[model samples]
Target: MALEYSDNMPHDEDDASDASSDVTELDANDFPDHFSEREGRLFHSHGSLPYPLPVDSPEQARLNNLHRILRDIVELHYLGPVAEVLCDVRGRQKRVLDLCTGTGSWPMDMARLFPGVKIYGLDIVPIATRRPERHVQFEIHDVTRRSRWNDGAMDFVHARSIDLAVTDYPKLLQEAARLLRPGGLFFSGEIGRYVDFAHGFSSDPAHQAPRAQRFFQVVNHSLQLRHLAPIADKIPSFIQLSRQFTVPTIQTFHIPIGDWHPNTVMRRIGKMYLNALKDFAESLKPMLRETGMTQHDIDNYVNGFIHDIEHVRGLVGVYHTAWARKL
Candidate 1:
């Protein structure tokens, strides 16, 4: 979150005396962003995107790390056939919508790669960046409710890590359908809420992460209280049942949790993913408090989860990405 660029304009030597007259100097430690702090972490103060995580620099770094890992694994900004859809066949720039655009990395990347594509990032708070590149715009809105945007207004829609924020996943899909023109594309990717092991791994003494499991169990309970639950697996069914999309594709990638993977590259990926998860566990502390857990209990669970993810080489998680084209 270091200042992207100096906000104050430079003045000539003669005008140095007048610099402080009109321009207020910003303190080195000054954070202009407003947020609600909990457990020493800053969370978004408003909007319908009730994602229970910090909106500060550390959380943003974690999100960006996860984004980089996903991109490195898939080696692409998206999984579906979107390049053709993004082509300007209508004699106008193609429209792209991103839901819960955390860190706004994906849309920004798309904007840079496809200058002709219009990328709209929707979120409750604008934590992405102060300056947006051309063809990239950010919108503040509630994802739990229908958006004010018109029907069939986009050529493509993208959503990631929205399982916790959006209460009704199926309804969101229906909303995506409403906003996508005929033959438009929709894509979503989510990391599993709970940890799972790689093949031939189990909860036995040799491979179990008991504390980690308990932490996620608590998380599941917490989510239920908030009218949200991990529904990454139901994404395909939701898309199919809608009957508004065709050729729906579903894929799951195994993400290693630590540096235990035998493959050199995977080990690197695992270490990076684990580093990101450590930050993620910290961000969940405030929300976990609402589950009636004592401060000591929250600290213990979070610390344990971090330790397990860092030390348990067999620890793994699943990333599910689903995409389809509007019929």
Candidate 2:
């Protein structure tokens, strides 16, 4: 049966033209395994979820409905530029690995763009894509586990938002360096703790704006207790660890909430961010219980997020993408 989609669904072109984005075209023999591209969507089976879930959830259901629409937005908005970095074909040879593949959008798009390079998508959970690109493969493996790749096996290792499941990021970096073939690159993109936006929302006294402040604080507090390094502060050190890796380059972007911008479309995009967060708050009921927080406390925390998302203007959250190559 053909998959049904909603009227509000976002498309791959809703954002920018990635094809026009800068790129270095390369040959197919750039990696060990060579696979060509096919037309129709690659992933089937699992529906897409509203947000990528951590492996701890152990929820393996296909997000076919949610993923088909949202994955494109994430790809264009978040992963596109980084994909370009990893897909660069000007070098000697390129073998790419995308960790925390989500719905496998990043790797799939990269493979489609560079049909010659071999790209691997790694995630703890399975993805829905079935694109017969011999150049790409999806593997179910934990990166936090000791890497199985021999020393210097890949040209690039990329991870995005995998910190939600990672307890020790620096250790993960050390592992990524070990897996990189000499002169390979290691890149990571991470969501900053929402609290960083607290100050930005404070200037505006919108209805839900104040609430976004508290909700993010609670989430940030919980994360800090878990010992995840603040995303911004750690990127530099992560790149500096080894003699083979060069200084990391960092790029930061904002995911604006509900169209606080002057433009109508931007307002709509902002609204979606707010809505996504509200829906996300509900899962906290069970999540809080696992954390040993009282239900009342969880309710207050989640409610704050909902109110701000709905009422705040010019409210935004940020994420960082940093990459470095081995010398």
Candidate 3:
């Protein structure tokens, strides 16, 4: 079930915004006027001070690659391919809204694949560098606030990797439901946990000194300090209990962090995951320092952890994909 591009499809002129005009490139200075910098990381002025992640070029590149990796791993646009999942819907024009759309990779790909769908990508900053397709648009908007989209106006609402961006999961889900038409699809994908192992990554759980797990613990603590909740693992329960959505489904993928897997494809994915983890370590250093660790200690720990993971192998992390339809 492949999605065919509809070149003759009519465009939605009303939903287009001028936000992309200034987004020709991802220069730090080009970021919204409200964005502030601290320790070389960008933070939204409207958010709960000190956004957890960096919006710099390297981070944006990491996110763009990650979006591609996830799309390949999940192997679908929605619960199924766009054609199979949305075949029943009766409409010549479909609309999609990606909340907290980093780099706008997913929406841009969707626009190319499903040319009839009007794709809107919203984020706190305009980090997306790609020129918008005729049907795609990027906008600066915070996902936590009430959206300007009319009720039941969207056919599909997609959010991914927003665990750090969202403060209230339930409220966001509610907002997603409101924006979706009855029977419309809502897809949420997140990293449920930082790192895991089939048996356990640590050979000696108790005796092992502060290392990889400790690094994740400190990172989680830093996020907690910023009022961000680690709720990705619980999204399924949150959706099932909401009562506004039906047929909730969750698909979990365990990506190896290093080239430990025997299979060729798994090894390739493992290497990619390792590279991503390295980027994470760099991005997370300032935040980990906030957790009472000295700068010297933070450097030693992060370097040691990266070295261990690179050599040891078998470290894995869980990525969760949760989808449901509005009732």
Best prediction by lDDT? 1
Query: Tens digit of lDDT per residue, candidate 3, span 272-292?
Result: 878888888898886777677
Error of 1 at 85 (Å): 1.1
* Model 3 misplaced stretches (Cα beyond 4 Å): 1-34, 41-50, 84-92, 199-210
lDDT of each: 0.78, 0.55, 0.72
Q: Of models 1 and 2, which has the larger lDDT?
A: 1
Q: Write the candidate numbers in order of decreasing TM-score.
A: 1, 3, 2
Please give me the total number of clashing residue pairs in predicted model 1: 0
Better of 1 and 3 by TM-score: 1
Q: Give the per-residue lDDT digits (tens) of candidate 1, residues 69-158.
A: 998777788888788898766545478889988778899998888887777777765577656776676655667677655777788999
Per-model TM-score on C-alpha atoms: 0.85, 0.68, 0.85
Instruction: Return whichever of 1 and 2 wins on TM-score.
Output: 1
lDDT of 2 by residue, 13-34 (tens): 2122111111222233531121
